[model samples]
Target chain A: MTELSELHEAPAPSHAGLDVGNVDELHEAITAQDKTRIRELLDLDLEHPAELADRLEQLSHSDRKTLAELCPDVFSPALLAELEDDVVEDVLPLLSSRQISRAMEELESDDAVQLFEELSDEAREEVLEELPEQERREIEESLSFDEETAGRLMQREFVAAPEFWTVGQTIDHMREQGERGGDNLPEKFFDVYVIDAHFHPIGYVPLSTLMRSQRGTLLRDLMDTNLTVITPDMDQEDVAYLFEKYDLISAPVVDADGRLTGMITVDDMVEVIQEENTEDMLALAGVSEAGLVDTVADTVKARAPWLFVNLLTAMLASSVISLFQNEISQLVALAVLMPIVASMGGNTGTQALTVAI
Target chain B: MTELSELHEAPAPSHAGLDVGNVDELHEAITAQDKTRIRELLDLDLEHPAELADRLEQLSHSDRKTLAELCPDVFSPALLAELEDDVVEDVLPLLSSRQISRAMEELESDDAVQLFEELSDEAREEVLEELPEQERREIEESLSFDEETAGRLMQREFVAAPEFWTVGQTIDHMREQGERGGDNLPEKFFDVYVIDAHFHPIGYVPLSTLMRSQRGTLLRDLMDTNLTVITPDMDQEDVAYLFEKYDLISAPVVDADGRLTGMITVDDMVEVIQEENTEDMLALAGVSEAGLVDTVADTVKARAPWLFVNLLTAMLASSVISLFQNEISQLVALAVLMPIVASMGGNTGTQALTVAI
Candidate 1:
């Protein structure tokens, strides 16, 4: 097993153990279009998709595309899921519609929808046509909901049991379904929603609760009835807030008639929390989103608009100071005091804004 | 069933559904020290610890003290766990050592250590003496770890099965443990570490996987050997990064000898992520931590030193401008031009700092 090399480990092999992450070596491989070296470099990271995506993100635009074309098989669905949306948009156009469609089909619906969202309009149309009707409809329904809503963020696959089921019956049902699994059940789920005959969730049983309970215990008796039900159209931020407030591992999402439609897990909420926090920080600094792989032009585009606003505001302030030029010519002391007064006000104003934000 | 009302509801009850969270009502009840009214107010919030903690945090300091006195029984271990560190520090002195020791015994060791850390040094000695020996040792062991390390953040209560055990035997072991439960297991856990004879964590299985697998499958066959083991000395921030990178629900914490000592779960990691992000945002503004319950004096205490430094820098700049005052007296245009150049450079410097941060 690889050591988690990025973490602050005790002096072990001088921190040079993660030589596989040396992007300079990969950059040369990409520059020379050396497929063998590229494959060797990638093999080290194939098991760690996020690390592979990070390497791809650090490469130049042309080099990344060259690497992708040299080993198109390296761009697995898991690798695609790990990539930044901005990077995915760059890479998606290079692959065929059949390849993109296959990846979407293989991924969880929530991730599939996100990847599909980044495709060009024409590519989306082509991919949708190629997809199975059921898969295509699932993607369309998720897209129908607004971006950053629970409907879009939730995975269509989940575990639910009826209220009348016993612990033994529930296990049997899940085991039989597991044997037949092909997107029928989520890869991981913490809570099994206890639902009524109408498929409306009444409560949830954590898997731990299920594991510890006797086989004959009824599902209703084991579940905590004070379930925090989430509506599909709820904002992702609010859904995240619910998860944090309740310390929930997963919550069932309901549709208009209060029937269970999907499930939203904590792993997705982690990403949303980070995204929201980054936006909050950037907003305070008067800048918009800027990703690592963003070009110099893109960085300039994001920062320049905010700087221009500050410049206009500064010019307006300076113009007012110019109005005092006559008074300053007679007594230069007035000019020094004036800047001091204005500067004090500006600093205090920003400090207040920072704390309030 | 209380609706998750703070979430955008689809016009259920005109958004007045969470009137139980009304601070004005609680404030009046608190100020009166009306025990009956306090109990009634507390009853509404009993099911939701975080909401109850939120109300306490919003009350005036004096009113809060009065309320705590009126209904000390309301300060449950779960409620204390939900509270901010600042709030807990203020409330610790009011409780008896026995009451505190009982709470610590009931809570998971991670939360117990956190609450124990906030006690007055004298109170810590008193509480430790009152606690049962094993409980005392657990808290003391956690306290020995540096603040915000994996050792401090992880709870000692985790499930581990021997490598030779089958799924059926493991479930039977958990069921037997459950029948004898007081704190033998965590209230919730997502993974089970499969350990070797030497008690080193070799791999793990998610509870979901265990639920779906056949009864007779060996844990060694079911476990994922590519486990991300966290050393107790690892920074909590780095541990949280691992969680996010791998989408881990929980991971085993090991000692220098690689023996599994404790488990850190995703819920704790979520809190750490938020705390780290908040610190990042505050550092950008040159301020320290300020919580909701902090007084005006405390707020000023956190913010003043940075402003003082800014003040010294401004005075230095003004002194330089004074040296040019003689030339400015002859040419008034210099006065206006000086402010413009200085102001422009200052804004650009701050903008660059914001982006860099």
Candidate 2:
């Protein structure tokens, strides 16, 4: 939380963090095993966790391990959260149980769930053991929900107010809560849900609207009743569609009984949109992963399954061509044109399939 | 703008707007050419422009044209903004110059630019001439920028404050401006840029922080200087990457001299992400467009160029195989095995290319 506050206070990182000079210098340092230079370069980027994550991703596997060993603190929770899933998987085993637990604790519930889900059973259990009782329970609860559902995507922290509250009262409450500086409020929120006595979210007021409205305006009057409510079991793609269709910044997640449970923000939706897009693109190409940062072995493994399927399809296509072999020998021209015909047909079929998808 | 306010006040449109029943009824009405029934169905969906857009897309080309002729207002600026580029292109010729110009004027600058860009030269001229002088200049200025750059993507209207202004001054300025209800301010804004004497953006204060902060706090003191400023020439894809990396809601778009020109909001970014993903997916498949709502003819036109390229490649591969024509005739088995080998190679090559991309 302190780091989160500091993140807002610090100037934005220079995009030059990924420039050729820095990468080459870091590569040279890692090559020479110059711990001092590596530490110096990393320390300069300490406040910019995203830049640090990008730098680590560009490093050799052993160099990444060495850097982690040299400065475990650089692999902060924010940095871990920012890393690609494959990169996180690679680095997670290198960290101690204490580091894993601390990172998990620092992340929001949804992010903590993602990190824990990626871990091996034994490591996950060890990290879970290190967490406090309350946080452990929350993570466990989140894990119970099916993957890629609203339940799994939503963060537990959210801001809610009774419908009867006035705009002034809500503002004062937020100010007082900000001063209190506890975990009761979301780290950042775009809107506040207005709930009824039964805790069913009746509507929502965008923070902008709340800010602009007269102080005496009741939350009920100010709230947009046309708010979209999401169910915990709803698929994440459907949730993303809702966000896009409505231009929603944040949405309230409801339980089976229609009571507000947690909230899903647009930042989470942004990630989901990217993930789903990657999934669709990869799946269409018959690969299992995006393979953006995959090692050679990983890429081979991902492609092997699709290639195996392709082999069977190829054999089937060949079998059909075999049936026409006798006719092909009678006419040499047939041999030349046969591939043209087959090629045309295959290309046309692929074209149809692509458009259909 | 009135529609925008109504959009906010009205309860979130029923996801049922595109339900099977309504679509069926609308389809039946269109097929039967029941103008009254079509109007009834569209009237029921008047408040839900997105749903209306979806329904219109699902219709046959003639039916969509008929529906447009029956009730042109149903094809509102928001609906035009929501339609697919291809669909919009198909429908644009059917609308009057007045309808086209009015729609452009009603939409935000980014959306207006998008709609205008899809028009044919003669129609674009007609629409531009029909528009008010000031709005025409704005759209023309937007068009002057290269497509897919920050300048093309940013809205002309945004909120910015002098660095020396206190939070109270900023709040009062916004309130007074809101009351004035002119086109000078963005319809919605999440943050206020704090600019220096030179009108260069120095930092920003999120609306939430502005609301929570004391009124007397100076803008310079309250602003979070850690801001990611986007240059007007920056590619939209690069802008999207920055937004994703930083989880940014909005970023300032600056000119060559570094003065803030306009702003790109998350809602626009969300649309850009979806468009980029669609582009990538289609490009990988070798198709020119997603062909989501395309007719058979349109689909063929879209796929023909890629299929032609495939034809050339296929012919080249066939020519390579023809080099061994003597060997193949001597051993009949070579004919059967040739296809298997070619198929396997093609599949493997495709797999590699997919991963590389």
Candidate 3:
């Protein structure tokens, strides 16, 4: 097993050796060692049991139902993040209440909220009851914020320092806190807010500056006052633009009183940028929302109504065509050339709309 | 002047200090002391200069002839990047030969190619002659590539290392190269291509892994074998899809013989992503492109053509409407609510088209 592992991690080819059958051959080679080849093959495609759960979801109901009977732990939260809502709804009902509770506890707030949003009311109540009191309260509190706002998107874990502290004190605090189980401070952070006695955000000290500054420097003097403070209720689009325009790594989210509540990091903003881009693209396309892990029926439902509207618009345009029908019948050249003109017009219009929207 | 300079640098209330009173005032604001401020404001709201340029170009011949005396460098390459092709044409003649040479030199190869492609035969010849021999050759060569190909969009600056080198040696090489003239390398980079003796890309080591790994790790050992190399002539859309599918940050571009030519960084890919999203959005809207910077006339032109094509298509649908006109005339409710069904259909079609496209 060790030798095979080493072989799998071998040095790269001098040039891209990607071939069409790469995934197939690689899988076959891995499975040649054992009769557990089928399970290994599935594991190869999915690095963990959890991812298998997600992909299995895309399969038909019977397939997932059968697969679940064999491997229940595949209903992991990581897998839930990857599943479409409809498929998730189908799969969640089949899972034991214990399994569902475990998955919710394991997932991030956003992913957990999304999965919870898809559940039937009765199922939600049952699952909520299963969670530890603290976890359930946090999830419920997070849910109270408007969907897609900073309050909802921000992770709860963050580090802050009082304005009067020195850089040395702040570092010592972080060190002590980490040792005492503060190790979960967001995997990445850019700035630490300096709050006043009342927790009002007075300034921000960037991590880079903190790293470079002398240890004894007072935190207040080291902080940047030209901060872009965001309201919890601000639209995600505005947040994304502020981040882009200011080249911000992180910004503090505050309430109406300007007190620091949560910090919005660049990583979260990256998702917002992508989402906003998707929204603009979808909206301009005339759908309020397009596929965000949408199923076939959901996709159909989302799109069909728009096409029907187009059919009506087409009908209206055809009435204009009928207005010129006598003129068209008198001169078929107008009909043929008319299409050319209209085609040109349509192309031009599309170009214009692309620029405008 | 120093006090004013300080005041200008200070961050003011949002939209408070904006003075859009006159063209000269807008010009002064655009060319402010802070380059960042200028860039930010240009991105914000203002009359689209391209629109003004188009209108000015259509003025009496005497007015058009005298417009060359206006501030020349105002038609900077950055501004040119923002302008539409038709608008670019109007402004080109107004620019002095020196300014033209400067703008040409400042522009990326792709942008230069695009601008030069729109110039009149005599103007192109004159401008081409004014450019340095090397730059003129580079632009002309790049212009020769088919539009919307990888060759058209790639930047010439990229970093690659020999496959035999350790990660330490590669980092040292990058530092040394940066110390020399490689400071002109793109502002951001992601992957370091490991090239063979003949300069063909063998594999890639992601920057993230490189940053985390021990310095002495061999490049070949660290490389990811699942390299996605793009050919110069590949369609940009396909390239974008590949990037999205593999979550690529950067990829090496290869020529017909599989020899590495240059690298395409993710920042460039980011622009492509935005452009493609915009294209899809507009295309789904039944328009070819969004005319964001278009004039009322340009907007009308862009939309009229599509509306015209729509007219023909509508007539086709109207013939259907006519077949049922009597049914509609008898049932007034059909006339009233028929539009509702069609409107819904149009919306649905757009939604589906948005997703499908």
Candidate 4:
């Protein structure tokens, strides 16, 4: 494996850092159907999965498909996770079921669930069947949770310890687990929950605190019991609010009877906050979605329903203008000033609605 | 310190969980100048600072002031941090300089900077003078950075170690620091930066890694060098994008020569994400700010500029209608359908703009 130090030494290919001039070159390559040039350009960005995703997003649908087909290895599991849902959906059919299953296996449960959501039902079944039984079970269990709930957000792999254990025991156990190279442990965790008998989490110890504490310190004594316990049924928005309110690094999710089930990390909450924010902003502007890389047809489809509702509201406003027809005829200025009044009122209403939301 | 378990055991006073019927009762208490009843009502919400902030936001300006005056303790530093800028501004003059300084003292640097931004120049001077010298200096240094930049967003107190230190040595250093309970250390930290002799951050070790590593492991070998380094002048929105892309828990900010300055944590980024979200949402609606707790006059002030701009645009639309006056007189039906067409075009333009933004 390439060490992080080597990765840091390599030039980072971030979306924001990409030159506008390079984009023109990229466009030229795509237009020429120059597979060799496209591969070279993609090679420059292959190390930075996010940048690869961004570059993919910048391409037209046909260009994206051609590039992906030409250099399938560039579309790694991490790269797929970095791509937007729309882009991922666009590319999912290009890959084999084994490839899709492999990507899902490598990702955290929440991210895998997200990719699963974007797949066609047929594709989903194929991919699920290809996955290892344990991975499939975890994904299926996560899918059992309603969309936009804590259950959907929490990762199944978490580190936990009995309350009776000391900090030293927990540390040793984690070291042993790491050495064993098992798939049971979380890929990364910030806190370890201290669970009581019957597997109810009583508290958690931040890794920083655990690191600084004495080996003899009991897990329960060192743990912070004031942490928020997330119920699986809690709405993602409420879960986000709880995280913001408490400045939580990670929170334990509990079953209905309060047994520890999974954990939701702040990283996931950050994504939720942005997603919810985008949804609210787009909804207010009478658009279903922002559709940054959307085709003309997609854009129209996303916006048509909101436009129809707006058409009704506009007609109602016009009808009220008609009610003053007699008044408008006496003073033609009324017709001229009429739109100003209506427009001002509309702007004011939007201002109030924006604030309220 | 109350354990989070005990806090959880206490009935959670949340805005969603608040009795809708009690809003009227709250209004009556304010109107009757019933301080005792108001105190009792607020006490019901005391455990949940965010809920208290929400309840306070729902009240009229005078009522919020009255409630604060009646029960000053309810407006704790945590509660103050949760309130909107406008609401905080309204209550600032109600408190003594001592109170303001104490609140500032209690909050994290990023939060303190927010409160500091809202204060009047005269009040700011008074509050600054009242703060302890070290805190005052820290606030001054932070204030020196431009608003909405990493410098303004970063907290000064962070953990760092010399690059040559071993894991055990670093852990021992943090333990001694935590034992000392000095103001120099960060109240909470996620990772320890490994610094060179020049105080430049070379790499960082997540506490999780530090906890699991052997005592003899060199800090240099344990640290992850593939880290994003933020500059002081970087915009907060860009900072947020980095956090989202990298799923960063914390990032180090460096000075011109790449010396470590401070760190920006994910907790502060959560708030920044929301604030930026609100700003973008309101800006789309043509409002200067989303003054959720604004008085009628404040609301008008916030909306007036947008309304004036709309007035200009509406008049332009009206002038276009006036250009067809002769045709309108001949066919009054033109007058009836004119607004429908105009409104539809307006809505379409907004939809395009929303998507582009």
Computed on alpha carbons, the lDDT of every model, listed in order, comes to: 0.83, 0.79, 0.61, 0.80
Best by lDDT: 1
Full-model lDDT, candidate 3? 0.61
Residue-level lDDT tens digits of model 1 in B115-154: 9999999999999999999999988888889998999999
Better of 1 and 3 by DockQ: 1
TM-score-sorted candidate list, best first: 1, 2, 4, 3
Instruction: Please give me the DockQ of candidate 3 compared with the native complex.
Output: 0.10
Error of 3 at A264 (Å): 7.1
Per-model TM-score, in order, reads 0.94, 0.89, 0.61, 0.87
Stretches of model 1 off by over 4 angstroms after superposition: A1-21, A31-34, A44-46, B1-21, B31-33, B44-46
lDDT of 2 by residue, A1-357 (tens): 222233332223355445557777987887787878877877744345676777778777887887777777778888888888888988999999999999888888888888888798899889999999999998988888899998999998888999999988997887777667645777767898998888878788987677566778899988877767787778898888888887889998877677778999998899899989878767776788744576789778878887787778878877876787777676545566566777788667765665565
Model 2 ranges off by over 4 Å: A1-20, A27-36, A43-47, A290-293, A316-328, B1-20, B27-40, B43-46, B61-70, B93-96, B312-326
Compared with the true structure, model 3 gives a TM-score of: 0.61
Model 1: per-residue Cα lDDT over A192-234, one tens digit each? 9988877878888999999998999999899887777887788
> B294-336 in candidate 3: lDDT tens per residue?
5678656655666666777756755665666455444433433
Model 4 shows how many backbone clashes?
3
Interface RMSD of 3: 10.0
Off by over 4 Å in 4: A1-46, A60-71, A308-334, B1-14, B17-48, B51-76, B94-96, B312-324
Candidate 3 chain B lDDT trough over 10 residues, lowest sum = B1-10
Candidate 2 global TM-score: 0.89
Q: Give the CA lDDT, 0 to 100, for residue A57 in model 3.
A: 40
lDDT of 2 by residue, B297-339 (tens): 9777888898888788878877877887777766656777766
